[model samples]
Every structure is written in C-alpha cells, then in structure tokens.
Target: MYLTSMVFLLLGSSTSLLMALFSLYKSVGYFIEWEIISTNSNSVVMTLILDWMSLLFLGFVMLISSMVIYYSGGYMEGDSNMNRFVYLVLMFVVSMVALIISPNLISILLGWDGLGLVSYCLVIYYQNEKSGAAGMLTALSNRVGDVAILLAISLLSVYGGWNFVFYLNSICNDISMGLLSFLVVLAAMTKSAQIPFSAWLPAAMAAPTPVSALVHSSTLVTAGVYLLVRFEPAMHGSKLSQLLLLLGGTTMFMAGLGANFEYDLKKIIALSTLSQLGVMMSVLGFGLADLAFFHLLSHALFKALLFMCAGVIIHSAKDYQDIRMMGGLSKLMPLTTFYMNLANLALCGMPFMAGFYSKDLILEMAFMGSINYISFFMYVFATGLTVCYTARLVYYSITGGFNMGSLHSVNDESSLLTNPMLLLALGAVAAGAMLSWLIVPYPYVICLSGFYKMVGVICMCFSCLGGLCYYLGSFLFILNSLNYYKAVVFSGSMWFLPFLSTQNLMFQFLLNGLYLHKMGDQGWFENKGGHNLHSSLMKSSVLLEKMQDNSIKLYMMTFLFWAVVSIIIM
Candidate 1:
C-alpha cells in the first residue's frame, strides 16, 4: 500500500509535467531526442515527439497505470507474489512509455516486443492450465505481428533508413514503399486484436483483474491503435486503409453482437474493448487519425474504470464472473454500483461522458463519409449494440436479484478499490469534452442531413429498447423460437471465435500442417536425404578405393567387367 501510494504520487507528478509539456509544445513544437546509432544515410535515433498527441496519451497512460497499481495493492492483498505482480505491471508501464515516446520504428521495436513479451508473462502469471493455454495463444498470436515488424524493418532498409518520420512523408509519392503500409496495417491489426487475430484478447481475461484494467485500458491493446495513429499519415487512402475501415466496422459489429450474448463479466468488458478498438480503427481508415486518437484516449479512461469496477465486483462476489450467478447488489454496494453504472453509461456513449465526444464524432463522420449503406448500417448497428450490451451488463450485474447464495457476502465500498475507480470515473465523465477541446484543434467536417444528425441519438434510444427487450425478455423467457438458442449460442460466444481459435477447423488445419512439416521436412528429410546421401557417397568411395587397390585379381575382374560392358554396348 505504501509503495503503491508512492508510485501514484510519482506518476501523478509525471502526468502533470507531461501536461505542461503538452501545453508548451503547442506554442513551439519540439522533438526531444537522442541519436543512438549514426550512419551516412540513416541514423537510428531515440526520439520523443512532444506534440499534444504524445503528451496527452503519455500522461493518460501513466495516470491510469498508476491508479491500477494502487488499486491492485488492495485487490491483490495477501498474495505471496504481490511484489512480483507489481514489478511486472511496472515493466508494462515502462514498455508503454517507450512505445508512446518513440518516433522511430526501430526504437518502437523495443517497446513493441517488450509489450508482447511482458504481457505473455503477465497472462500466464496465474500459473494454471487455463492461464498457460491463454498465454501461449496470446504470445504466439502477437508473435505474428512481431515478425511483421521485423519484416517491415527489413523492407525499410530499401530506403536506407529506419526513421518512419523521414519515410512517412515520402509514402504518397514513392509507390515502391506501399508494402510498408500493408506491413504496418497487419502489425496494427495483430496488436489491436482485429479480425482473425481477435481471439487472444478475451482469452487474456485469464490474467488478474488489475492486468486487465491496465493493459486493456491504455497499454497492450491500445498500442496497435496508437501505432496506426502514428502511421496514419503514411497509410491513409491506401488499400490497407480501406481494408482497415471495412475490418474495423465489421469488428465493431461482431464484438457488440458478441457482448450481448456473453455471460462472463470480464468477457463482456473485453468484447467491449474490441468493439471500441474497431471504432478507432474504422475512423483511422477514413483518414481521420486525429478523431481515432481522440477516441482512443476517451475509451481508455472509461474502459479502465469499467474493468476496475468489475474487479471490485468480482472480489465482492468471491470471483463469480458469471452474471447468471449475480443479482441485485445495488443495495448492498451502493458506492461500487454507482461507479460501475457511471462507467457503463459512459461506455454506452450516454451524453456528456467521455465516449460521447469521440464515438458520436466517429458515427457522424461514418455517416458523412463516402461509404456504402452497408458500412453506415454497420456503424449504426454497432453503436446501438454498444448501448444494448452495456445496459444488459448493468441490469444483470447490479439491478438483478442477489443470486450468489445466502452465505456469500457483498460489500458496497472499498476505499482501496473505489479510490482508483473514482479517479477514473471522474475522467470518464469529463474527459470527452476535455480531450476533444485539447486534442482536436479543429472540428470534424460533419455535413450530415439534419435528420441524419439525429440518427445517432435515435439509435441509442432504439438500443435502449433492444436492451430493455433483452433484459425484460430474458426473465420472461419470451424467445422460445428455434433460432433463439442458436442466436444466443453463436453471438453470445463471440461467434465461437474462442472455439475457432483453440479447436476449430482453422486451428486443426494449422496444427495438422505443422505436424506434417515436422514429420516430413524436418524428420524425414534429415534421415533420408542427409544420411542417405552420406551413405551412398561412402559406399561409392569404398568401391572406388577397392578398384584402385588393383592387384592381379582386381585387374582381371575389371577386364572381365569391361569386356562384358563392351559386349553389352555392342
């Protein structure tokens, strides 16, 4: 507790200093950097871009991580390895800082790989079979992006420099460097857990709650979005950008739908993160990197708060993550429920919350952009889904009956837990307006029809209807149709993405392919091609040596063979 308080104070000071720098840099832009390696065409430099974006983002990362650390002190009390957990979280923050500060891609690797490696360690920190499986899935899936980054670095060598700042400008004219855009998008998708790479995130819920709060908030998951925000100048208008736009919208829809079906408290929150990340990605795909960054910041605040609240609930309910097992805890834990509600409503983009500023702006832009109705419907559907699931989460977790058996106890408040949650809840309430004013110097060019302008509001109302219907309908047992169970099973389980990732056809195919390669290429090739080649050569050499050791008998045999060969030839 003493250490966490100290760390929070230290991080608070750092955040204030960075905010001051954020203010100062607006008047005079500056790159605080130190060159690490020098070459004729390229010099590898450790650089920090001190524009408002980096400063604001860096400040938020420090603040949230520090608060998470503080919350963990209470959340993790009595654990033998609490010290180890704290150190791991501290390292995660260090890597996150490195990622936020880096302007050079080569230097970004240090942070990028650090996040992957440390997250793997943290994911498996629980030391159980579930944790072990989740860790491997998380690490290996991220390994694809790591390899993509290394390939990107190699591809970057063609320009004789690894500084993305230098090359990003040339991206528009130098058609040759288009591959870099693809590589970057791929890397970002992997890091952010988009599409096929999306499975590891919810699986990562096997980690302790503090790790989820810190990592999912502004560190591990957001790293990829931040990377895209940095690379947006280069990737905008490219095929990769188009794909991100499409993929992002789909991810948002997929995750929102999945959240409605989910029962686990943590999984629902994880799915919400996925949906929010999709919103950021889609906006960036539309070439609005600033808007995307703004959403990223806003999402970080509330989402972190949401997870912290979930942690408190999980602790109170004695780790019953299933909402089915939970009930009306609002009376028991009024304070915690209030914080949870604030976070949930904010996540729903309820007016004036942090999510409203960015999400509404994104939805407005999505409607206004030169997109097909399919894309527009995706945006609208996904937005409504967000509200519906959040409403469901609140209804199930807080407003429902107390189903945790009579003996189990529920606490309404814990200062150790609520302190950090309250701090974040404050941000979640105010950050939308605050960040919008600070980050976006200009407003979005929203040229929607007046009727369309109200669509987002109406969509939320309709989403409220959907949530009401689902919640009221769940208890009423109204949906008894044939497809109802199928819909719940499919969408509720994240399109069975978890199953697909672990034991589905794709995993089976890949697993079999790997086995075949090991058996044939590695095992069979070494035995047959390698050893057989040596044995054949050795036998030939022995026969030649015998022939060369020519005595009278050998000469006679040779002569007889030659005569026989000659006869055969004739």
Candidate 2:
C-alpha cells in the first residue's frame, strides 16, 4: 500500500513539474489576465505579463521540485505515514509553483502563506517535543515577518490607490519606492534567516532529513531570493539595497564561522545553507539580480545533494549525527564518502564545480561595481570564509577520528537511500557546465583584470589550506593538552572568538542564544504587560467558576440584579 501511494504521489508531482516547464517554454509570447475582487465594490484586475526573467525562475523552480520529490520518495520509504508526508510535500511544490507564476502581490502572498503553513506541519511531523518546539518557533518567526509585509501592502494600497494591474503598470510611480524596497528587504532577510532572525533555522534540524533538504536548500528559503529578483525594478536605487548588501555580506561571514565550529553534521549543513543564502542576497544587493537567481538555481542542486549524502552517512552510522564520532568511514562507505566530498568541494567554490561559477560572479561584480572599497573587501573576505568552513566540514566528516564505537557493527538495509545520493552527486558535478546555456543572455560580464583573478585565486587557496592546517593543529593540541583546549576554547569562549577567557559571562550568553531570545521574551512579558494580564485572567476565571457551582438560587439572583441595574443605567 505504501509503495503504491508513493508511486502515485511521484506521478502527480512529476506531471505538475512538466506542465510548468512547458508553460515556461511557451511564456516567451504568452500573456495572462485575471480579476481579483476587493472588500469594497471595486474590482482589481491584473495581468501576468511574462518575459525571459519569469520564465527562467519558473523553469528553475520546476526542475528543483522534481528532484526533491524523487529524493523524498526514497528518503521516506517504509515509514508508516508515507502517504501523509507525500501529500504535504506535493502541496509545498504547488504553493511554490503558484508563487512563481502569480502576477500581483496578493496572489503571491496567498502562495507564500500556504507554503509557510505546510512547512510548519512538516517540521513537526515526527510528533516529538523537540520537533514541535522547533516548528512553533519557525511559524512564529515567519508570522512576524508576514505582519510586516501586510502593513507594507496596506500602506501601498491606501496611498497609491492603484489596483493590482495598475500597480504593476506603474510600480515606480505609485509607491514611495523607498518604503516598498525596505519592506521587501526585511521580508527577505526574515525568510532567509539572516543574522538576528537566523536562530530558527539551526533548531529546525529536528525535522526529517528530506524535509530539511527541501525546505533549507531548494524550495522555501529560496523564495526570499526569488522575491528580490522578481521585484528588482522597484528596489534599484534605494537605501534598502545598500543595507541588504552589508547585512548579507556580514551574514555570510558569520554563518561560515558557525558552520566550522558545529559538531553535528546536519547543523553544519544548515549553517552552510544560511551562508549561501547570504551570498545570493549580496548578489541581489549588487544589482545582479539575474546572477543571484542563477546562483539560487545551482545552490539548490548542490546543497540538496550534500544533505542527502549526510543523510546516508547518518543512517549507516545508526543515527549518530556528530561528526566527531565519525572517521575513516570512507573505507567502509566509499560511495557515500565520494559523493559527500565531491559536493563539499563544489560548496567550497572549487573551480569547475557548480558553486564556483555563481560565487566568482558575485565576487567579480562586487569588485567591479559602484560599491565602495570597504564593501568589496568585506565580500571577498566572506567568500574566503566560505572556503574555510566548507573544508572543515569535509575533513571532520571523513578523516578526523575513528570513534565510531559499536554503532557501525550493523549496516543500513535500504538501498533506496544510496540511489538518490548517486543521482544528486552527478548533479553537483555537472550542473555548472549547463549554466551558460540555461540562462538567457548569461549575465556575468567577466571584466576582472588579470591581477584581480590572480588575487582571488590566491585568497581561495589560502582559505582552504589555512582551514585544513587549523583543524589538524587543533586536533593535535587537544590530544596533547586536552584540558586546556576544553576549558579555555570549547567551554569558556564564544563560538565566533574561541580565545576569549571571559568564561562565566560568555557561557551565560551562549546558553541563551547570545541573549537575543531572552531579551525578546522579556520585552514581550514585561514591557507589554502580558504577565499581569495573564494573572488577572486566571483569577477572574476561577471566581466565575466558583460562583457558577455554588448554587442555582445565587446565580438567578445575580442575573436578576444585573438586569435591573442595566435597565436603570440605560
């Protein structure tokens, strides 16, 4: 029964993907029109006038979704709730499809909200306490972002008074282009988990591996980058664009650092997802919206492959996710190891891999464009950090230790898992080769001076080599002086700066997610008077229940007295 259900689900998703690809092909000359009724008497009409850009994004989304669906079937095999999982997965693709095709803001919001809800459900599908908590956090964070988007939309409607069609027709004229740009940027940062809004993503590793791959790598998070790319014209010359550039650059650097320090394999990948999104965000900031979209396309392919490889390792290791406990498994699991390392190299921006093309384009754009020297240096440094952390992940997973203990005594029974990893591994290698043809009028200008490319290559070499040396030195130092490394570096210091010796203060802050969550929760209950209101509600409810249970005569007399008082007051 489960097998049949899975087959049916795959069929539906594949058919939808094919239809979308066909539509994208036909969209070169096609046009669409629709009507949306408002609460008022007037009707708002719109047209989804397609062009090369929309078709490109549409095709990218479809191709990625098809791969996700195929991998999901293998990942979920033998699970009892296979049917339910497939249903939600398909719904997620449908929502993304609608979002890509929608002409106006309202239609896009409908699809966006649907995807958010389905993602929340998928996060909590395991029904465990940890998964439930993570899902709630994801939903709350997204809801706050949604409220900001709603306010911006309402303000635009009130001030501009332009219907859907007219707004698109005169997008630049109707709105305070500045305000619209700010709102959209905020929405994108929140959705993509940049900086202060980024804690939710690491916690979301509690979900199934397939869910993590689909949401983090391919579909849900990519929506934010897609939005910025789609609405580039409205945001071109605003302060928000500069802010996006700075924030995205900073996020990439910080996230790469965090990924390097993480012990869990899944958390490492989660952090990489954030770092890559930051790079894409920076590309959008540089006005290379087409390049940003193309990077998003390639990232989906390689990152998903990496996650699937990690899943295979975890499954074979008997659910052990800590990279510290894994080593030399390349001998036992040669195929899995090869795929993982291949994907990791691509992720590190090695030449000829999928990531190299997109990342190099962004770096070149940052240097050559109107962005100041400081911003350009920051981006280049972040790219170097990307290489450092990616190398750390690959080394730790395959070489650091042989502490597998007794877990690998038994092996994984499912051949289904290996099949998807093999397919994705091939993608990680070959996807970039197709980029020149896939995108129309390939966006990169390649204006880098010979000196510049040489400097960039040197930086890449240093990052990779430096990271490997650091990892090896740290390991040997730990083996020699175990107490020193643990007491000063691992236990006392922050994740970013591991040499700082302020143990008590750093430990307190780190335990609470750097005090950000504590501050937000305190502000909600204290400044908002939520605690006092809750106490009052509880006391009043208790009194009412007691009065109701005391006596029928007492209740009747109370009601009569209230009725007489009401009439006299009136």
Candidate 3:
C-alpha cells in the first residue's frame, strides 16, 4: 500500500512540475462552460477556468497532498480505519482540485461543500468526544462561509451569470453591485478562519496530523485565499477590500498573541497557521493579491513540514501533545529535531528561507504603502510575536529539560515519515529563492527612511527578547499563576474561544434551536395537530360506517317511513 502511494506521489509531483512549466511556456487561459439552466433574468452554468493562477494553485495542492498521503502511510498504519482515512484524503484532494478549477459560484459551491463535508468526516474519524466537538465546530464554522457564498451568489444575480471572472472588468463601474465583494470577503473570512471564525482551526487539531498538514498546507484553509485571489480584480479599490484589510490585520495580531501563550504543540502550530493566514489575507485585502498568493505557496511548504515534525514528536511521545511534557528530544531524535528546527526557522521568516521571501515582501509593502498606525502596529507586532512564540516553542519542546518519565523510546524509526519531512525540508530551505525569482523578479519600490526600514529587523531582535522573557517567565510561580493568571490563562486558552464555539456562542444557540425544534416543534405540534387530525378522521370514518348499515331490514324500514310521509303530504 505504501508503495502504491509512493507511485501516486511521484505522479503528482511530476504532474505539478509539468503544469508549472506549461504555465510558464505554453498555457493560455481558457474557460469551459456547460450551461445548466438559463432564464431571461439569470443563468447557471458549470464553469471550469484554466488559467495561470488556477493551474499554479492546483499544482501546489496536488504536490502538498501527495506528500501528506505518503507521510500518512507510517503515521496511520495501525489505525483500524486506515482505508477510510485514505479515501477521505483522496476526496479532500479532489474537492480542492474542483475548487481551484471552478470559475463560477455554482461550480465553486460543489467543491466548497465537498470540502466542508469531507473535513468534518476526517475530523471525527477518531470518534472520540474531542474529535466530535472539533468536527462540529469545523463544520459549523465553514457553513458560515458557505452561506456567505450563497448570499454572494444571490447578490451576483444582477450580472446574469455566476461567473464573476467574466464580469470583473465591468464590476468596478457599478457601486450597487459592490455588495458582492462584501459577501465574498465575509465568506473568505470564515473559510480562512479569520477572527471570530478562528476557534475551529486550532480545535481541528483533534484530527490526525497528516490531515492537519493537508488542510493547513493547501486544501481547506487555502480555499478562501484562492477565492480572494480569483476575485481580486473585482474587489479592487472597494470599501469591502479595505474592510478586509483591517480584519485581516486584526486576525494576524490576535493569532500571534495567542500562539505566544499556548502550551499545546499542535495548537500552537495551528495558531501559527492562523497568523500566517492573516498575513496572506491582509495582503490580498491590500489589493496585492499576487503577494498573498506568493506567501500562500511559501507558507504551505514550511507550514506543512512544521505539522509533520509535530506529528513525529507526538507519536514518539505517545500522544502527549503538551510541550511542557516534551524536552531534550534532540539527543534522542536527532533527525526529527533537525527537520523541526529547519521548519521553525523557515516559519520565523529567517533569511533565505521560504517564509523570508514572501513575508518580508508583505511587511515591506505594508510599511511603504499608505498604511495607518493600526495596520503598521499589526504587521510589526504580529511578526515579532510569530518569531517570539516559535523561539519559545523550540526552547520548551526541543532544548529545555527532559520533562517526561522514561517509559518510551523517542527516535526516528520510520523512514516513511522522515522521508516526507526531508522532502518538505528541501522546500522549506530553497523554495523561497526559487519561487521568489519566478513570482517576483522585480520587487516593489519601498521608499522609506533608513531607520524606518529597519523596523522589521528591530522587531525580530525584540522577538528574541520576548521569546526569552516568555520562556523564563513560565518558571516563575507569580507570573505563571498568581497576579497575571487571568491574562496568562486567557491568551493561553485562545481567549476561551473553544468554549465560545462549542458552548458559549452561536453553536450553543444552534444546539438550543435544535433541541427546541425536536421537543417543542415535533413533540407539541405532533400531538396537537397531527394527533387531533388523526382522531377526527377516525371518528368520522366510524360515524360513516354506522350510517351505512348493510342490514336489509333497516334499509326497508327507512324507505317505508319516507314513502308514508310522502303519501300523507300529498
């Protein structure tokens, strides 16, 4: 089975390379349309768009999914439902492909809903309470995006077709049609897990690590960014775009702050994904969709590797996901630690790494462009927080004292797992340089004062201070538990977001509505209306049966009485 999966990986990788080459040399964009229905007012069609952007994203998705599938062979080997897992992953890839190729809302929803459904299945694959709760949160959160898309579809009816690509040039001329962009941005927010929808991204860490790799890397979360990328032209220069910019910046800051306080290995990584997603989204909202796309690709390479490394550690530690229980594994699992360190370095936007080329560009753009204090602060603080938490995490889980008891051996025993990490590590190391050349050969002009230009560097250095402080501060009882307990615990638990998503927020209200529907709706309505109607029909049937007596004597007496009465009246 692993051998078969290896073949699949090669095919996917080869196909992606070919597509990338074709995208550069020979590909000319085209749209294939199949008319589903047509009316005077509006038309629905299945539109497949093959363009440079779509092809690029499709290739990336295939490449990342291929690696994740190969990696899963070792990780999920002992599970009873391994086949189910594999099938779900394959469906996930197909849905992502569908989403990338879709040129219209009608076709997009097919892929979008497929993603939501398949992701829920994957999240709940373990069938535990945590997985169940995570799956529900994941599903409901994405449903908000789905509904947003539906609203956008309705608003887009004025254009007479679902294909926004066809109308991008003309859309700017109409302010009334601008509502579509707002709906689209709202949809993007939910799909990308920005701000209020963010609780689910970390909770979804309940899934197996390979699923997280696939999702965070290229499939589920990237769908929203891809949407914005495709819709960029239409949304340009609109208030909706500016609104997204602010929201994206806020999400970036929020996630970065949260990651610094998190103790869970996977959740911290998940929060980092959220933070980077905010960067991609904010760039797009700034109307530089190309920059966002570049960051998206780079982030996928390193972030996927990050999640794979986390998987190795957790598996070796016997499912202990808390970093407090992990320490000094570098001596035991040298290879895993090497891969882990490389991925983390790339995540921090270290020089020459995958994150550096894109994230640096994003920050510089924000600095040079017409940006306000809030956005400037967000970029600087978010970048610092990213590095700070990453450094702190490395100290906790890799270099600090060995916190766990001697019960299990921790080493890189599986070649299957390490091989995938190695492959992704190569990307984490060199993809930035390679893709930077391809994606952005000539950089955007940043006319800033020398001191102002050093802002990003200053923040990075400050991040070192922040990381050390956070790590050391964790040891002090007063800081960890006493006076700052509320602040510490608040950020540590993602601002009680899990509770908000599951019990304290919209989902709880939804659950209550379901309960009301079951008890009040079905229960009372059934007895009062359905039961009464049933009794009334039964009573009428009995009365009719008694009146229709089949006895001949009763019929003759009734006839004779009627005949005598008629004669007396005459």
Estimate, for each residue in 113-191, the C-alpha lDDT of model 1 and write its tens digit: 9999999999999899999999988987898899889989998888776777767878756788888788888899999
List the candidates ranked by lDDT, beginning with the highest: 3, 1, 2
Q: Which stretches of candidate 1 lie over 4 Å from their true place?
A: 1-27, 32-45, 478-483, 505-570
Alpha-carbon TM-score of each model against the true structure = 0.88, 0.78, 0.88
Please state the error at residue 265 of candidate 1 in Å: 0.5
Error of 3 at 229 (Å): 1.1
Indicate whether candidate 2 or candidate 3 has the larger TM-score. 3
Sort the predicted structures by TM-score, highest score first.
1, 3, 2
Better-scoring candidate (TM-score), 1 or 2: 1
lDDT of 2 by residue, 331-360 (tens): 677777787888888887788888777777
Clashes of 2: 0
Count clashing residue pairs in model 1.
5
Local distance difference test scores for all models: 0.84, 0.72, 0.85
Clashing pairs in 1: 261-492, 327-401, 328-400, 328-401, 333-412
| Cα distance off (Å), candidate 1, residue 180 | 1.6
Return the top candidate by lDDT.
3
